[model samples]
Target: MTDVQPIVRLAARGDGVTADGRFAALAAIGDMVDFARDPPQVVPGPEHAPPPCRHFPVCGGCQLQHLTDTAYAEFAADRLRRVLPGLDPVIMAVALSPPRSRRRASLKALKRGNKLILGFHTEGTHKVVDVQQCEVIDARLFALLAPLRGLLSGVLADGQGAGVALTLTDTGIDLLLANVTADRLDRIEALLNFADAHDLARLSIEGPAGTETMVERRPPQLTMGGIAVTLPPAPFLQATPEGEAALVAAVLAGCEGAARVADLFCGLGTFALPLSRQAQVLAVDAAGPALAALNSAARMAGRRIDVQHRDLFRRPLTPAELAVLDAVVFDPPRAGAEAQARALAASVVPVVVAVSCNPNTFGRDAKILIEGGYRIEALWPVAQFRWSSHVELIARFVRPG
Candidate 1:
């Protein structure tokens, strides 16, 4: 809590409960997780940044923002090594994307009356802080913080125990003002006008089901790899354009001649389209909307891709159903694919590339594939989210006799 306290750190500190019932290693991540709330006021870095937001260290959003760039990446690389111990591949390169402006989703704390308050969770605990300025937010979205504060301040009689949620993308902003009733639609609509009046490209009002509806669901227009793509408020678009390309490049490097490839849990085909250059892609996801978006992107790019909607978790595509896939890019959610991991390892496919955000799950699943006679060929640890104790990694495991 204070600067004088010596740092108690863990090399592979984790979050969440582990099998032994301890938090997952917070320190052992490719991202930064400083145990101290307020970063030391005296630490040195580029003095050019817009002065540190008063909540810089107190807000749990970004860590190590004050650390020098070189120092930060080294801190990140250590976490990557601990996470993916089996590959032992040299880091090809650490691509530093420009600082963030592309956060599309955020949760807020809520309050009411003299007690009205809606913001982010406070440091160390689940309590919420009345966030005024978020350094991590984009210029467009960041500017709305105060206006949103004022909007909520007037609309809500009191927000003592409530909270709000938000979304920001290239297009505009979305504020999920909580605790709204159908009777209050008029006042809420007026709030949307206020957001629009502020030159917000677009705004949507979302809340508990019936009480919430999109005032404007203008999906953001974005282009990637020379292909135009659009996404509803949600879908896993890489938060930064540079990070997206870097990740795609990593996936593509491993995907050469990967004929009849299966893109698991594919969101918007970041990997699928590029891989399709010399291969046929079968993109699968449970979300119909995301699947639809993928198909459109493929079409817009003049590339052919087969999109399937299915819950890969409950049921992965049966091995018999798989085409003659020479290689596979399995990008599943954090809870790594135990069933599919085993299935792919057992399959006749020669290569399996896994892109994961969680290390423990990746390690366990990689262990599964390795047991099935697959050998780790390469490891690519990506530091996309630099401020949290989390990192994304891509690994290629080749099947063995």
Candidate 2:
């Protein structure tokens, strides 16, 4: 083990106690190569657990597993505060119970020996975790885990190995065989027989290179917080039902009412279409297929959405266009947008809202907006990715010019 003390410091807690001048056991969210540059500390009091994955630090699948849930949230909130020290976020209630959330997830898979192991990526690596059961799966899917493992083992005992993920529902589960293709349907047919015999309820299996809708029959769509959203095949939607609703509510509460709005890095119009009813919105994203689905959904919802498939990174919103925008919101991927953040900061829109999955990047970009004459109004944290310690956030920025 390398000595991480020099770079590590204790974090601050509002109601939490500090020991020996340290904020407990905190990990500095600094540069990977140079850990000494700027590190965020983890609180030491809470008991930290190694994630269920064996490939913990090596694979980099779960970054914050070592932190206790309390410590983890504190670190997340602290990261935001450090970036924009003026804005201290009010931490909301965390969905601590499993099976109560996570309606769907697009999981990776792998076959080991004679068993199919199903779990997320191991730490930072591509290797799949050899999991007996996931702690953070849908409640219904949680029950099907053992039998499905057995079914895979029995059906393909002596055959070639592969991995599969299940989409949970109130009725049953939908299984997706990631590596299997139509060419191997004869063999897949055999597995389906075994699943039927074993009674793996409503298991719909498919391959990566399949037809228009790989799901065959569409999966259960969710109405998260007054928003009628459909789960189209493999688009990136939140796993948990409650978690998704909470996130959308937070974003909506930020954008009370505004006109000539823009949502950058919008995915499936998660925040865009819903907010459209309140304002004239333009949703821009790079994924052509996802944007198409969003357009279809918008049409179905009887809502007007200006969908544009453009790379928000390479071609960011110019100040000229920003000059007309009254409000802005974005649900960017893990790698937050530095370029778009800059543009939003320079925009004439007095109110700017940013939604991000990664805290470190959000912290970095929030610091930029703060310096650009924007005062952060409210910072809200949401723990949608539970058990994994991944924190999501939405911050409302106001430019008083």
Candidate 3:
């Protein structure tokens, strides 16, 4: 009859799963589901809590808000456990960022007549949710939404839409507007006045001529490990400070006592700048703008960091070059570094730290290193993008003598 099937856990996409294998949305652990009917019905259980944000199951920003704190943390940890089984890797910690702590976000804005709608896209759809309040982004950033909508109403043409990427930097908010046009000079003036009124550190617009900076009161910067990195326009910044700290700490722990290190895919020198305080770090990445910014910051900070603008996938650091470094740290994008991992496997570097946002790719890379005589020592999972299936982690490996 399937009278009552208790939901035991949550799936990767935030859907609750029953012990017998039924999926239900907006269901949490300890919830009871009745699958006897044509469609299942979910009844909230003890672990279910009220979602803090008004927009839940609608706005795509958050997914697991209905889960209690304990359950939420468990869900994040399970993400890693599912990938690395029987390895018994040391679990250092599972750091979770608090609500309203995210420093960077990209939102969609569509102008419908005189009204301007601004918020995240609806779950799995291009339709905008028009969020009134967000639980995952900083309060300072959320406060700008109303004012931004007001300004966007005038900037966007009828039925036109734009994408806004907002980041909270050291100086102030850095905003990048995409698909926005200013046919008249007054539109440009309005943008300048808006930046002036809000004291924005920088404001850039993407039009037919490409991205053009409208205002820059000061260079937008973000301090990582005591080094000030000048952020490039729409550069990749860590979503949460807590998640970044966890990753840096893990990387530094793995890199302890090394005189020389290599940071591959080093975006803006997140780990390189900090490791430079002790070791000589050579930062490599394909991103020219990011490398240029990192190099400038290193020069300004008087740190011994060599920035190399090279695509690792196309031309990974060979075993000979990697052999010179005492240790290596690579934080590749979601698509893990396959060719680079193979190169690293053949290298004689004693220690290697792999940071990734995707568990599947991390596992594949870990397998390659393990087969090449590297021992997985520690694993630290970080829930930087809170309440979502997205997970970031740092795995430390050491080659036996």
Candidate 4:
């Protein structure tokens, strides 16, 4: 009889591991793995779940869909615990976004002889999986797939590929097609007709020449902190509305009494706009369009937010500049905010709210802050990307007064 290994935990990349260091893909915690088999077979455990999507293990969009909600939450929390081992900050309950809540997605499109395949690429491959049904994205967004297939069939050349970016804005769906030509009058007309028929908020196409806005029935917009801000084409947005709300709530709670705040990398004022309500916020970012949108929204709403267009990577705020602020909130990209974190560590700011999508970088940055006499007060793990390996978190750090 082969001795079965019980999967104890999940690795950073969503692979399950046994107590003795064996790894199994798609194996959930508490699952039993038979290592004797050519490819270890995983016996479903209490934590294992039937993946809701048919494309599981194939579609690169999701990885841990085989994990039950309880197991998924544990996976997210475990990621933080593994990354920030010694810090032992208060890890709040995981905030898991429900299915069919994703507001944005980037899909691949390919013209295969008489048919158009439109969906995410297969795991670690460029091959597009003609998605018949998707469980993660908004149903409204998924509903457009059929029409999009019909529309692109006429636009794309044989054996050609294109990129499709779909975003659910406040007004309606914002569509951007890349690497496709629409210079001809008929092709352009087809695109315009599709946008008008589907009531697209905005539509744009990108080719070797550049991006061109073919149609703008209505300006694409997104409401941040109760303020309506027109969005730039395919602007950065939190994956889901529920996830955005959770991050905002955590950041707000962390900087509860701050009178003056600096929102670093404040794209489209996700945190800055809300922070502006209670504090004088100085919002800074490198993206000009995001800053412009944020500035326009702030001015129209009569909010006290100073928007500055500066690349934090090249020139992070000096400690002296950050010293005046009571609290600082920085939400950088996946690379994390190493340079900015160093400056914040050296600053005399009382409170620092760090929002990160990568745990390893966040842990490194947290260590820098701790080394500078700052202690983490709380950390909230958010499963914004749902079943994917991606985990986002908002942590509060305080310098002992």
Q: Best candidate per lDDT, number?
A: 4
Model 2 vs. true fold: TM: 0.75
Ranking by lDDT: 4, 3, 1, 2
Per-residue alpha-carbon lDDT of candidate 3 for residues 321-359, written as tens digits (9 for 90 to 100):
998999999999999999999999999999999999999
**What lDDT tens digits, residue by residue, belong to model 4 across residues 144-239?**
999999999999999999999999998999999998888799999999999999999999998888779999999999888899999988889999
In model 1, the worst 10-residue window by lDDT is 40-49
Model 4: pairs clashing at backbone N, Cα or C within 3 Å: none
Write one digit per residue (lDDT tens) for candidate 2, span 1-401.
Answer: 23233323324322122232333222432211222334543323334544654454444334555556665565655645565555665555543324336766555544567667655676446776655554556656666666666655544544445555565543345565544544466656766664565444344444454523233343434453244555444447766666666677777887887777888888777778778878878889998766777777787777767888899889888878878877888778888889988877776778888888777788888887888888887777776666444667788888887
Q: How high is each candidate's TM-score?
A: 0.80, 0.75, 0.97, 0.99
Worst 10 residues of 2 by lDDT: 26-35
Q: Residue-wise lDDT of candidate 1 within 260-372, one digit each (tens)?
A: 78888888777877777778888888987777887888886777688888888889876666547878888888898888887776678888888888888988898888888
lDDT of 1 at 303: 77
Candidate 1: residue 54 lDDT (0-100): 75
Winner of 3 and 4 under TM-score = 4
Model 3: pairs clashing at backbone N, Cα or C within 3 Å = none
